[model samples]
Target: MLIVTTLIACILAVLFIRLSFGVIRLRRQYRVGLGSGGVDDLERAIRAQANFAEYVPIALILMACLELNGAPLWLIAILGIAFVAGRLIHAKGINQPPPHFSNRVIGMKFTITTLIVLVVFNLAWLLLQLWK
Candidate 1:
């Protein structure tokens, strides 16, 4: 479980770094001069960062719980990878034009499925612990 948590944390760290760099690149590209482009880029960066911050912690917490609850290590690994992949896809989709379902849908569903797994694992763990 600790291993899984560490792995997930590392992956998240990398994702955040990439996200920051992406925002910086966007700002540098669009905000080349004194104009609205810079402001728009900043707005987009803030929204992206805010959205990621809002969801990541919850996902991490649940993922940690799942790991601690004796969920299969493979599941943990797969979920961890899926989480990062989904975030990346979602990011790419959002950074582009309209109708970004291809990535967003997969990411959203992956996250939702992980949440459900966490819930089930935690409840089962609690029940087992209480049964003794």
Candidate 2:
């Protein structure tokens, strides 16, 4: 069972819904149907949602693979937690004004680090299986 991945995916799903609704709310407020309507907040909201959509699926896939391949439960939990926390921080940072760049940087660091680790771990596991 993909317990860790399931939990992480659920959390990500909720965050995604929140980000999506944020875009919708901004669109309604700005009266733009197709784009940000030249509104900065709306633009930020759109990008936040778009960025989340762009990064999450593959992360979840990698995480699920790790779990399915019998990676350590603790490692999976840590990675999942880091990814979720990173996404939350990034969403908050991206939605804020320009002064909060650190949040974005830190968040991306966590997210990217998690991805790299997942990739390495998955690759190592696959190689080990092949060698066996």
Candidate 3:
């Protein structure tokens, strides 16, 4: 749980750094009034933050529950790392130009992986308890 917590903190840190870069770019893009990417960047940043806030808490809660239900700590750590990596990939994808959607593809992979990990952990816990 502690490792997961730490990893989540790291994800937040990484997100902040990436968000700062985006914001800076947005500011420059809108220096005169508002350019094409300016509003898009602002919207993207806001939506990204909101989306992170919405999903991350639930992910953390699920991870914590798994821990409480006797899931291996190492598994939790791995999932946490996956979540962070997915977000990093997502950020990269968002920042890149067209045809370079690597970040988005990676982000989706990570997100799906994290979700699967959480589901499997919960289901395993349920089966273990039932068998006991």
lDDT score, candidate 1, position 126: 72
Q: Write the per-residue lDDT of candidate 1 for residues 25-118, one digit (tens) a residue.
A: 7767776433336465555555555567677787788778777767678877877787777677666666555536676777677766766766
Each model's Cα RMSD: 3.4, 1.1, 3.5
Please, what is the whole-model Cα lDDT of each candidate in the order they appear?
0.70, 0.92, 0.70
Tens-digit lDDT string for candidate 2 (44-125):
9998899899889999999999999988989999999999999999999999976378998888998999999999999999
Regions of model 3 farther than 4 Å from truth: 1-3, 6-10, 13-38, 97-99
lDDT value for model 1: 0.70
Ranked by lDDT, the better of candidates 1 and 2 is 2
Candidate 2 residue 124 C-alpha distance from true site, Å: 1.0
Clashing residue pairs in candidate 3 are 93-103
Return the lDDT, model 2, position 120: 98
Taking all chains together, the TM-score of candidate 2 against the true structure is: 0.95
To one decimal, what is the Cα RMSD in angstroms of model 3 from the true structure?
3.5
Error of 1 at 26 (Å): 2.3
Model 3 C-alpha lDDT versus the unseen true structure: 0.70
Give the Cα-based TM-score of candidate 1 against the true structure. Answer: 0.75
